[model samples]
Target chain A: MKALALGILAALILLTAPGSQALAAEASEAPGAKPLAVGTAFPDVPLIGPVSPELADSLGIPQNGPTPIAKVKAEALIVEIFSMYCPFCQRDTPTVNELAALIDKRGLAGRVKIIGIGAGNSDTEVDIFRKKFKVPFALFSDATFAVHSAVGQVGTPYYYVLKKTPQGFTIVAAHLGLIHSPADFLADVVAKAGL
Target chain B: MRRIVPLLTLAALLWIAPAMAADPIPGGLAGNIYPVPTLPPTDSQLAVAVGSPMPDFDLPTITGGRVKLSDYLGKKNLVITFVPAAWTPVCSGQWPGYNIARDIFEDNDAALIGITLDNIPTLYAWTRQMGDLWFPVASDFWPHGGLAQKLGILRSDGVSERALFLVDKKGVIRFIDVHDINARPDLGPLLEAMAKVHAEK
Candidate 1:
């Protein structure tokens, strides 16, 4: 009798558990949540790690695998959400490379850093993109979409500039589509980032 | 009271679980359904067949100017990709996937030509959002799916099948794929097909 009663209890829990219910609530809430806009403090979102080798080499940062966003040692950071299969991302490659070049040319490399999160792409796909475009910045794959969820990303080729402040970081700017001109993009970033 | 409360909470969880599965992605398109079409279009009279010479047509392009199939025959290979329509889920992302694979087509000395029943303006606007497609996008819109109908892949829905036909240097149909309208064909098969045709030369 006790065994039968225990089996019934287990079945009830599997069929109607609060833990699973809570997870579903969270999933529903994610899509409806207010997006982080400019001037809003950047949330302490967790980052997927083992940063790409090329990016680590470019930034001269030692690869201390699986680092957090808070641990990134930079005055300001530009986060680009992209995907390998996204044609817009492919088309936007040269412009992004230009931004990286401008940062280096203007000597902003020491203060400003750019990193890309490949939304819904695998590491191999991200590697293909990095190689194809010869990207000079760090790019990470967020195949599980954790990073995308953190940023509330709607599509690829999204941009967000985060300025480091004493109290962590604040989003300085956000753009939805292509940055038509590299010079203008740099100027806007410099002005908004207050660098 | 506490024992009864557990049962009540369980009932609530059961009531809400299924509804929660359809949560929307924030700032994303709503009512986005990707039901894979089960019934493949019945095999109709196909226009071009294997070992047959592809018929030439000067169809209007999305980026202006017309594309003539015979023009590329002597100089380069050609791959014509025909998707069903605009704004559909799979169709929206399909061409963009090809946009990134420009090198694959270039290496094989082939040019990709995307076609659809939609008019030039529709293709222009839709492809513009797809970002700088390196290939020419054509419209088989004039005769209301005339080109696709000639190829015999046009479905009864007045749209082309998600098809691909690889024509070699002699303008011969070397490979063809009348892919499932509901599915995105893998790129590997296309690449392999390109290699096979390249070897024949």
Candidate 2:
């Protein structure tokens, strides 16, 4: 009876642990798929747009044609996987914009680049989301869900921080759901990326 | 047993605390959204046609007001969308998407009306999870999908079809998309259609 009670307590703790719901949800949403872990190779998914010249220069990619994420010229890259249809993403727009601004304010803009991919959203749909939210970073359209599939079909507002390596990029940290505080999140990214 | 009771109670408290805390956006990604099974592409035949007058409706909205289809006849173009029911996979994901597209609708001088066969109470509960929507959501419940039936989209299983009807300022249906039941209809064609209708004299 003592052993059974202990087992029940452990299960309850695991179930109610912070972020446990999101983890369980991610597993159910994409069965057999796993979240990209720290020290794992970040997928070199092709991104559709960086329409503006400045954004292109920042990412070290061309204005046209699909560009692989590995080609981005930065010491660290923050990739946000989102969906226009996600209420959470819509609500987190302001905080995400603040995160980009915080990066610039901290003088990490040169070493860190932030970008977003709209999972399953068409180009027009992406544009609408961008305009409505006034997002500062370059956003790519995953109209065909190619990027979404390549990245494990994670839920919206998912964040991945990657550190540039000689061979390619390495996932340093991954977060699911809202960035509670832009300053704190960027600080963590800066610390994780060692920049 | 007495010692174990306190431990179990502490575990329960930890489990309930986070859920009870005020969430800025309730029913968000972490909220109660259910996954549905893949359904047939198209379940019912459309009764309405392009260029025909869409039947006017005065349905109860989730906001506790009646929205008449003819209200925007001369002033604004309209996009009427009918999904099977509320709280399902595609239906839940669809309208929240439109929340961010308020500008698109405003730019084209169009109003979007979302309708489902669920009652107003159910719709009110369901949409609350989607956050505040920019457009009105009306219920077609009392008559049991009366408008859906008039539009010839009520499925044999008693739910409405996943469909879209673009009605111009003159109340003429300009475009119709009886999309596949399981998939989300691409927004490109609808935007193009709205642009076309907005450009018309």
Candidate 3:
């Protein structure tokens, strides 16, 4: 009876917490569309760019062409959906860079690749974001919101871990909002992608 | 009873954690942005023209300092932006987007001044969600859109139109974009104009 009372009390505190309530309110306001679920086939997103020589070598794609997501040479891929205007994305820039460094530290640089899609941002906007944050990954513009719509219009700073298979790319994990711990997030990505 | 004490304590921490992390700005994804209805495209007429001397004004900033258009005349080029109001949709997203474009202004040796009809306290509360902005935000509140009225972008609803003015170091307006009241002005063109102005100098 005492344990039951404690559980109920704990549950009550969580339920009534101002932060939780605010989160719930915000969640409701978010689009009802669900993100690409894990175990689902990832779409072949066409990314446009004046792809830098370094990014081309990293993804093993041509420097001047629209590269499809599935065509990128990688055993596993981390897709970060962000917006140049998103404060959370701005705050998470360093952490996401740290995640990339962590990937290199784990010797997963060749096998695991990361890229960012600037939702609803033009090439100029993406360029500004890239330069401002000194982002170390290849970022593509979704100026027309085509990629955003393709990815279900989920909120900014959304992450997707996908594994390449003979069939296609399959979603391994999908996360929304700020990544609290880059190390843990990379660990999860590594484990889920089996890399 | 001892076990219950720790459990309650843990519950209390859980309750306080989110509150501590709560952002003062209300909305979630991109700071405290509230979704507002799409307004009419262009609401007001442009009173000032390109090549005309921009009407000078002394306005109070959110930081409690006063800024005069004349103060920047001989020193730096100016890009003055006027938004309709605070806490609304396009207005909220517009300034934060400029946060990343600081280098563009700096590259051209230009200073950006964001203006809104909202008073200092309201602007302070609304801008807190934008984190650290690279420019000063001024409130044109005393005569309520006095500066806006001088520039002739004040709307019928007692707010200014969403507009931008690129003023050269000579205090002569080089470009004027009385943009649609409902949408954000594109940064690319503004940057291009700033570059052109710098080239002329």
State the local distance difference test value for candidate 3: 0.83
Ranking 2 against 3 by TM-score, winner: 2
- Specify the poorest-scoring 10-residue window by lDDT in model 3 chain B: B23-32
Pairs with steric clashes in candidate 1: A31-B26
Ranked by TM-score, the better of candidates 1 and 3 is 3
Q: What does candidate 3's lDDT look like per residue over B45-87, in tens digits? A: 7788998998989999999998998889889999999998897
Pull out the clashing pairs in model 2: B41-B181
Candidate 2, CAPRI quality class derived from DockQ: acceptable
Instruction: Give the poorly placed runs of model 2, Cα more than 4 Å off.
Output: A1-33, B1-30
Per-residue alpha-carbon lDDT of model 2 for B132-181, expressed as tens digits? 88899999997898999899999888888899999988899999999888
Write model 1 residue lDDT over B78-197, tens digit each, in one string: 899998887666677678767777787888888889999999998887777565778999999988988887789888878888888999999899888888776566665677788788
Stretches off by above 4 angstroms in model 1 are A1-34, A37-52, A59-75, A83-95, A106-111, A118-134, A140-150, A163-173, A178-195, B1-75, B86-103, B120-134, B146-156, B163-201
1 or 2: which has the higher lDDT? Answer: 2
TM-score of chain B of each: 0.79, 0.85, 0.86
* Candidate 3, superposed: residue stretches over 4 Å from native: A1-33, B1-32
The TM-score values for the models, in the order shown, are 0.55, 0.85, 0.83
Can you rank all candidates by DockQ, best first? 2, 3, 1
